[model samples]
Target: MLRHFAHPKRLTLVAVPLAVLVAVAVTPQVRGQQGAGAFESSDEVRAAIARAERASKRADRRAQSLERAAGQAEQEAEKIASQSAALAARIQETEAEIAVGKGQLQLIARQQRALDARLGERREPLIRLTGALQNFSRRPLVLSVFRPGSIRESMYLRAVLETTIPQVRGRTAALRAEIDKSRALRAEAEGVLRKLAEEEDRLSLRRTQLAAIETRKRLAARRRGGEADRQEERALAYAEQARDLDGLVDRIDAAGALRDELAELPGPILRPTRPSQARASGTTTRIPPSTSRTVRSPSGLRLPVDGRTLRGFGSVDSKGARSEGLLIRAGAGAQVVTPAPGRVAFSGPFRGYDRIVIIEHPNGWTSLITGLARSDVNVGDTLAEGAPLGVAPPDGGAIGFELRLGGRSANPLDHLSR
Candidate 1:
C-alpha cells in the first residue's frame, strides 16, 4: 500500500470547503431546535434535534437528486437541439435536391415539347410519301421501265426511306429517355417530402418534453419563494412585537404608579384564540387540550426551563437577599416558551434582570420570568401554552422564575406535571 500525501495549501483549501458544507448541513437542524423550552424533558429536545438533522440530510439528498435530474434534462435538451439542427440542415439539403430534380423535369418537358413539334411538322410530308409508295406498289415492275418519271420518282422515294428510318428510331429513343427522367424526378421529390415529415414529428416530441421540464422547474421555484416570504413575515412580526413590549415595560418602570393599576385587573380571563380552527360548515372549532397528569394542579403550570435547578423558592442569594423565585441554568440562546396559557402582563428590561416577562393566568396566578436576551411577546397579548415568550441568554447564564398566587409567592415545582 502507498501512503497518500498532499500539499499543505491544497489540503487547506479542500478542508475549508468541506467544513463549510458540514456547517451548512447542520444549520436547518439547529434552527428547528430554537424553542427548546417547548419540550417537557431534555431527552425530547435531544430527540427533536436528532430528527431535524436526519430530515435535513434527507432533504439534501433529495435536492441532489433533483439537481441530477435537472442536469440530465438539460443535457437531453442540448442533444435534441443538436439533432434538430442536423435534421433541419438535412431537410434543406433534400429540398435543394428536390428543386434540382424539378428543374431537370422542366428541361425534359421542354425537350419533349420540341420533339413533338418537329414530329407534327413532319406529319404532312409523311402522309404524301405514304400515297406515293402505295401507288408505286400497285404497278408492275415492267411498267415502271416504260414510265421514266415513275422510275425517277420511285428512286427518289427509296432514297428518302433509307435516311428517314434511322431518324425515326433516334427520335423515339429520345422521347422514352425523357419520360424515364421525369419518373425518377417525381420519385426523388416524394422521398424527400416523406423524410421531412418524419423529422418534423421528432422535433415536436422533443419540444413537448422540454416544455414539461421547464414547467416543473417554475413550480418548484414558486413554492420556495412563497416559503421564504412567509418566514420573513413571521420574523418581522416578532421583531415589531418585541420592540413594543420593551417600550411598554420601560414606561411602567419609570412611572412606579402602574403597580396599583395592574392589581385592579378584572377576574375573568379571555381564552386564547390560538390553536383554534374553523370548520368547513362555517363554524369555529377548537383543538383538544393536552392531557394533564396533576389533578390538583391549581396553576396548571409547566417547567419553563430544563437545566439544573440552582436555588428553590424563598432562598437566600449571595447578596443575602431572599429570592422570590427559582434560579435555573439553561442553554445559551435557548428559546423560552410560555409555561401556561395566559395574557402578557409585563415584558421589558428590569433593574437587575437583563430582560423580564410576566404572564397573568387564570385563578389569580401570575408568573414572572426574567434573565432573557430579548422577549418575543408584548404586554396585553394573549398566548397559548408552550408558545414562544423570549430568548434565553448565553455564557452560562441562569434564568429566574416566580409563580405568585394572589400576592404571595408559590413554589413553581409544586404545580408542575413532572
Candidate 2:
C-alpha cells in the first residue's frame, strides 16, 4: 500500500518545487511585459502583423500617389523634394511597422516555447498516473485478498483509488485541453512569424527602391560639392562664431525681430490715380489708403495637419525622454501647412529632427515643424497662413511641431484654437 502511494506522494513533493521554480522564473518576464505593454493574445499578434502589412501596402500606394502629385507640382524643386521626402518617410514608417511585427512574432514564439515546456513537465506525472490506473484495473478487487494488508486497509485503498481515479482523469483532461491550446498557439505563432517575414520582405523592397532614389540624389548633390563646400565653410564659420545652437537661434531671431519691428512701422505710401481723376484734380486725386487690420493675437490657428496628437509637450516616450513639442501621427503623404503667417527662418534637416521648417511669426512667436521628409519653403520665404511647408511620407508616422515664444518652447495646445 505504501509503495502504491509513494509515486503520487513523491510527485506532489516534486511538483511543489517545480511550480515554485516556474513562478520564480516567469514572474520577472511577466512584469517586464506588463511594463512594456499589455500582453498580447494570438489574435492580437495576428492583428498587429495585419496592421503592419496594411501600413506597407499603404506606403506603396502612397509612393505612387506622391509621384503622380509631384508631376503636377508647381516647381521642379517642389516636385523632386515632395516625391523624395514622401518616399523616404513611407519607407521609414514601413520599416518601423515591420520591426514591431517581428517583435510580436518573437513574443509569440517565447509563449509557445514556454507552453511546450509546461506540457513536457506534466508528461511524467500523467504517464505514472495512467500506469497506476491501468495496473489497478488489471488486478481486480478479488486480488486484494491475496495482498499482504488488512481487509479494512484494502477497502480503504480501494476507496481512495476510486476517488483518485476521477481526480486524475479530470486533471488529465485539463492538461490535454491545455496541450491542445498550446499546440494551437504554436501553430498560430508560426503563421504570425511567416506573415511578419513576408512584411519584412516587402519593407526591404521599399527600402531598396528608396536607396536607389537616394543614390541618384546623392550623385546630384555631389555635382554641387564645390559650391556646397563654400556654403559649408561659411556655415562652419558662423557656427564657430556663434558657439552653440541656442546662440545661433538667438542671433537669427534677433535679425528676424528687427525685420518684424520695421514691418510693424508704417511705410511711405503713394496711391495710384486714374487719368480722368488726374485731369479733374489738375494733377491727381489720391485713392483712399486701405486700413490695415492689426493681427496681434495668436488665437484661432488651425492644426498643421489632420491627425491624432500622440504626444504633447512634456510627454515622455519609452526611453523617458520628454517631448519639447506636439507629436502628431498624420495621414500618409499628408501636407503639413503653416498654422499662421510667418517668415521661414530655416528650412533644412537638423540632427534627429529630420527635414524641418522653422518660421518666425510676429509677436516673438516662431513655429518649428519637424519629421517631414521634404521641406517646401526655404529660409526668408514668407508663408501665408495655411501655406504648405512640407510633406509627410506615405504610411504616415510622427510629425512634431513646437511653438516657441521669443526662442522659448511652449505647449502648442495653449496657443492653437480648440
Candidate 3:
C-alpha cells in the first residue's frame, strides 16, 4: 500500500524539481517561442526543438507574405521605370522644339529691324511733304505743259506726297502686328517647354520612390522566406514529438501490464481496472435528472456577446471535435452572466480551465462556464439564466459556455432559448 501510494508522491517530488531544472536550462534557448508546452509529457527535457519548430513556422509565413509583396513592388517598379522613360523622351522632344523656336525668334528679330529702317525712311518723306504742302497751298500750279519750273516741280511733288507716305505708314503698321503675333507664339512655346520639364521632373521623382518601395518589398520577402522555412521545420518537429509521445505511452502501458502480479505479491493490493471498466465507473459520466436541472437546448443557439460570430459550432474542417461551446468576446469588464437556471456545482480553477462555474439543471444536463475573471457563485448556489455572475476583463479570452448531456459534449446553442 505504501509503495502504491508512495509512487505518485515520489514522482511528483522528482517531477517538480526536474521541471524547475529544465526551465532554468531551456530559458535562454526558448526565449522567443510563444505557444509550445513547457515540458514533455513523460519527463522534463530541454525541448528546445519545440522552440525551433515554432520559430520556423513563424518565419515561413512571414516569408510567404513578404514574397508576395515583393513581387507586386517589382511589377510597380517596372511600370514606373517605363513611365520615366516616356517622360524622358517627351523632355527631349521639348528641348528640340525649344531650339527651333529660338532660331525662328532670331530670324523674326532681324526682319523686325529691317522693317524699322524702312519706317524711318518713310518718316522723312512724310515730313518733307508736309512742308511742301504748306508752301503749295499758297500758290497754284500752271495748267500748260510748258510752264514755269517751280509750278511743274510742285505738281510732281503733290503726286508723290499722296501715294508714297500713305503706303509706308500702312506697311509699317502691318509689320508691327506681325511682330506682336510672333512674340506671343514664342512666349507660348517657352511656357509649354517649362511645363514639360516640370512633368519630367515629377516622373523622375516617382521613379526614385518606386525604387525605394521595391527595396523594402524585397527585404520583407527575404524575411518572410526565412520564416516559412522555419515553420515547415516546426510542423515536422511536432510530428516527431507526437510520435515520441505515442511510443512513451505504449511503453508505460506495457510496464504497467503486470498490475495483477504486483497486487498478488505486495502488502496492500490495489487491483487495476481495465480501460473500459474504469471509464464506465467514472463519476462524471452523467448526473441524473433528479440531481441536475441545467439541461442543453434542443437547437437554435444564440451568441452571448454582441459581436458577430466569428466561427460556427460544428466546422467539419476542424482537426478536433467541433467546439462544444460558444466563445463570446465581450468588451473589457463586461458582465458575465448565466445562460440558464441551475445550481452551481463546481466553481474555481480546473485543469486547462481558468475561473470556471458548472451549472446542473433540472434535466440532468450541465453547462460549463469558463474563462471568467471572477466566479461569484459557489458549489450548491443556484443561478437563473442571464443573472450576473462576474465581470469579464479584457484579454480574459472569450467566455466559453459548453453543454453536456450524460457527460457527453453537446452543442450549447441547441439548448439556449434566446
Candidate 4:
C-alpha cells in the first residue's frame, strides 16, 4: 500500500489538488494587496467619470438653451440675416449634443475595460482547477478501491475537494457579476453611438440651410450695385498700408468715425423768395437731430462664440506681446455671432489674419474678429444683436475677438452679460 501511494502517478494526483489549494489560499492575500492598489487607481477613474458626467450634463443644458434660441429666431425671421442666425444656433446645438455623446462613450469604454480586467484576474486559477477536477472526476470510485492504497487516497482527495470547492464557487459568482457589468457597458456604448449619429445628421442639415441663406444674401448684395464693393476696396487698401493688426484696426476705426461724421451732416436748405413775406409768415427752419447717437458704453455684451477662453485682454501671447483681445479655443466650424447690434464696417480677409469682420457699434464701440473660414456679411450690412457673423476655421482653430472703445482695448469679460 505504501509503495502504491509512492507511485509517481498517484503522487501527481495528490499534488495537483494540493497545488490548487495552495494557489487558492495564497492568491487572495496577493490579490488583496493588488486590490488595494486597484482601489487607488479606480479612485482616479471614478473622478474622471464624475468629471465626464458633469461635462455631459452641461452640454445637455447648453444644447437645450441653444435649441430654444434657434426656435425663437426662426419664428422672428423676416430677413436673410435672422434666418442665418437661427440656423447657426441649430448647428451649435447639434455640436453640443455631439459633445455629450462623446463623453458618454468615453465613460462607457473605461467601465468596460475595468470589468474585463477584473474578470481576467479572477479566471486564471479557476481555469487550472477546472482541468484538474475534470481529470479526477473521470476516474471511477470503484476502480480507485480496486487499486492498492487507492481507497485512502480517494478519501483524502474528497476531503480536500470539500474544503476548496466552496471558495471556487464564490469566485465564479463574482466573475459572473463582472461579465454582466461589461455587457451593460457595451449596450450603453451602442446607445450613445446611435445618438451621436443623429446629432451629426442634424448638424449637416443645419449647415446646408445656412449655406442657402448666405447664397440669397450674396445675390441681393450683387443687385444693390458697386457701392459695397468700393467700400471693401477702400478698406483693403487701408489694410495694405497698415503696419500691424492694431494699426489696421486703428485705420478702420478712423474710417468709421469719418463715415459717421458724413452721415450726421445736414442736407441743403432752401432760401425764401421774399424777405417781407418770410417775416410775415413767422415760420422758422428746424435742423434735424444728429443720427450718430452716442452712448456711455456698449451694453448687454456676450461671447461671440461658444468656447474656452485661452487668453484674456492684457495676457502675454506667444509673440511676447501683450494681448489686446480674447483668444478662444473653439471647435471646428463653430458659429460666430454679434455680441451687440452693429453695422459691418469691414468684412473680408486682411494681411495674415485670415477672413475678418469689423463691426462698428454705437458710442464708438468697435468689435474686431479674426480667424474665420468664411465671411457671410458684406460691408455696410446692419446686424442685430446675436446675428450670425460667420464660422470658425474648419480644422478647429483659435478665434481672436477684440473690443475697442475709443481705440482703446477693454477686457471683454468685464462687459459680458452676467
Candidate 5:
C-alpha cells in the first residue's frame, strides 16, 4: 500500500490538487507572516477606503451645487435683458459635469485594478486545482485500486478529498463574487462615459448660443453710431491719465458725480399764461424730490462670478500690497455678471490688467472687475443686476473684483446676500 501511494502518477494527481487547495486556504496567513513591510495592513486599507468615500461625496456635492447654480442663472436670464449670461452658465455647468464624470471613470478604473489583483492572487492556484480534479475524474476508480494504494490508503485519500473539495468550492464562490463586482464597476464606468458625452454635446450647444447673442449685441452697438465710441474714448483717456488703479477709480467717480449733478439740474422754468391764474396757484413753489436710483448697501448684490476667493479684501499678497478687492479663482471661461444695476463707465483693456470693466452704480457705488479675456458690454451700456458683463480667461485664470463706495474700497463679501 505504501508503494502504491508513492507511485508518481497517483502522487501527482492527489498532491497537486491538495497543494493548490492548501495554498489558497493559507494565503492570508502567509501574507500576514510576511509583515506590513511586504503588504498593506488592515488600517491602511480602511484609511484608503475612507479617503475614496470622502472624494466621492465631495464630487456629488459639487455636481449638485453646479446644477442649482445653472437653474438659478437660467431664471435670472429670463428676467434680464441678456441671454449670454444664461448660456455661459449652462456651458460652465456642462463642463463641471463632464469633469465629475471623468473623475468617476478614474475611480472605477482603480477599483477594477484592485479587483484584477485580487483575482490574480488566486488564479494560478484555482487553475491547478481544476486541472488535477479533471485528471482524477477521467481515471477509473477500479483502475486506481489495481494500480496504486490498498483499501486503507484508498480510504485515507477519500477522506482528504472530502475535506479539500469543499474548501475549493468556497474559494471559487468568493472569486465569482469578486468577478461580479468587477462587472458592476465596468458598467458604472460605461454610464459615466455616456454622461460625459452628453455633457460635451450640451457644452457645444451653449457655446454656439452665447456666440450668436454676443454677435447680435455687437451689431446693435454698432448701429447706435459713434456715441458709444466717443464714451469709450473718454474712458480710455481717463485710464491713460490716471497713475494707478485707485487714481483711475477716483477719476471715474468724479466724472460720475458730475454727470449725476448735471442730470439733477432743473430745466428752464416756464411762465404762466395768465397773471391771475399764476396768482391763483400756490405762492410757495415745492421742489420735486430726486428720482435717481440708488442702492443703500450691497446686501442684495450677487457675486460677479462663481468661484472661491483667493484673496479677500484687505489681505496682503506676496508683494506685500494689500488687496483692495476679491481675487477669485474661477473655472475656465466662467461667466462674469454685473453685481447690481449699473451703467458701464469703462469697458476695455487697461494697462497690463487684461480686459477690465468699471460699472457705475447709483449713490456713489462702483464695481470694478479685471482679468477678462473678452468684454461683452461697451462703455455707456446700461445693465440690470445679473447682466452678463463678460467671461473670465479661458485657462481658469483668477479675476479681481473691487467694490467702492464714494471712492473707498470695501469688502464685497461683507454685504453679499447670504
Candidate 6:
C-alpha cells in the first residue's frame, strides 16, 4: 500500500498532486467554519464584492434622486409660501373691501333714515298740495294753473310745478340706485373672501403632500444607509481575507527560497560492494555487484539515503505510462542524503519534491534527493560519498531517491549492492 502511493508512475504522480491540493483547500474550510464565521469561498467573496459595488451604485443614484426631489420640494414650498403670502394679502384686501362695503351700506342706511324723516315732516304740506293739484292738475302742486291770477303768473307757476315734480322723482330714483349699488358691492366682496378661503385650503393640501414627500425620502435614505453599512462590513471582511492571503504567499515564498538552496547540494553515494566484504561460494546472488549505477549508464551510482525500499523503481501505472521522479517514504523531517560526490545542481522545491536536492556528477550523471525532513546543504555546494547531508530518522524510513543520466531516469537498483 505504501509502495503504491510512493511510486512515481503516471497515475500515481498525477493523482497524488491533485489530492494534496484538494486536501489543503478543503481542510482549512472545515476547520475555519468551526471557529470563524462561515468561511466564504473565493467565488462567494467575489460575488459579495460585486454585490456591494452594485448596491453602492444604486444608492448613489437614489441619493441623487432624493436630493433632487428635496430640492424641488423646497422650491415648490417656496413658491407655495409666495402664493400663500399673496393669498393672505388678497384676503386682507378683501377684508378691507368688505369694510368699505359695510361703510357704504351704513351711509346708505343713514341717508334712507334722513330721507324718511324729511318726507314725514313734509307729509301735511304734501297732502294739501296733492289735494289742490288733484282738483286742477294731474301732478301734486300745479300752482299756476290753480291761481290763474295773470297770464304770465299762471305760465310761470305751471313751469315750476312741472319741474319740481320731475326733479323730486329723479332724486328718489337716484337714492334707490345708490343703495342697490352698495348692496351689490358688499355681495361681491363676500364672494372674493370665499374664493380666498378655498385657495388657502388648496395650499394646505399641497403642504401636506410636501410633508409626505419629505417623509418618504427620509425613509428611503435610512433604508439605503442600512444597506450601505452592511456592504461596508462585507468589504472589510474581504479586505481582511486579502491581507491573510498576502501573508500566506509570503511564507510560501520563504519556504521556496529555502528549498532552492537545498537543491544544489551533493547527495550520498551507493557503493555496489564493500571493499572488504566477499560473498560466499556456490550461492546465487540475485544481483552481481558490477552493474552500471548511473541513470543513463550501467554502472557508477549511489544510494540517496540509508533506508529500506519503501517503494521500488518502475512504472506501475495501468493506464498509459507517465514517468515521474521517485517518492521516498522517509519519516517526516528525516535528513535526506546525497547519492554521490557531485556538484549541487538544484536546491529547490519542485512540484513533486516538496524539499529536494539535485546533484551533478563528474560523469554525465545526476541524482535527485527528495523527501528531506530538513535540508542541510545549499545550491553550488560540493559533497562527497558518506557526507553528513542531514540528520536521519532514528527509526528508519525510505528516502525518496532517483538517479538520472544526462536528464533521463535510471533504475536505482542497478547501482546498489547485490
Best by lDDT: 4
lDDT of 5 by residue, 96-154 (tens): 55545544555565566676688788788767766766676566556656755555556
CA error at residue 279 for candidate 6, angstroms = 62
Pairs of residues at least 3 apart in sequence or in different chains that clash in candidate 5 = none
Which model is ahead, 5 or 6, in terms of TM-score?
5
Per-model TM values vs. the true structure: 0.32, 0.50, 0.29, 0.73, 0.64, 0.27
Q: Write the per-residue lDDT of candidate 3 for residues 61-171, one digit (tens) a residue.
A: 433443444455556544433332232222223322333333333343444345445545544543454455445444533343366585556556544544554454454
Per-candidate clashes come to: 0, 0, 21, 0, 0, 26
Q: Write the per-residue lDDT of candidate 2 for residues 53-74, one digit (tens) a residue.
A: 5655654564566667678899
lDDT of 4 by residue, 1-418 (tens): 5454344554444455455444433332112211223223555545544543453454345445545555566433344565566566567656656655655565555565666576567667766776776687668666876789988888788667666655655656566566556656666677777888888898898889888887887787788899988987887788789898888889988887777677767677566887566544467544433334554556657677766577888988688999988998666788787777798888888778999999888878899998888888888787765677888988768889999976889888878765
Question: Rank order by lDDT, top first?
Answer: 4, 5, 2, 1, 3, 6
Which residue pairs in candidate 4 collide?
none
| TM accuracy, model 4 | 0.73
Pick by TM-score: 2 or 4, better one: 4
Q: What is the lDDT of residue 190 in candidate 5?
A: 67
In angstroms, the error of model 2 at 205 is 2.6
Tell me the spans in candidate 1 whose CA falls farther than 4 Å from its real position.
1-299
Off by over 4 Å in 4: 1-77, 127-155, 274-300
Per-residue C-alpha lDDT of model 6 across residues 340-391, encoded as one tens digit per residue = 5665545544444345565666545556676555555544445543333443
**Between prediction 3 and prediction 5, which has the larger lDDT?**
5
Clashing pairs for predicted structure model 2, backbone only: none
Q: What is the C-alpha RMSD of each candidate to the true structure, in Å?
A: 37.5, 10.1, 39.6, 8.3, 9.7, 47.8
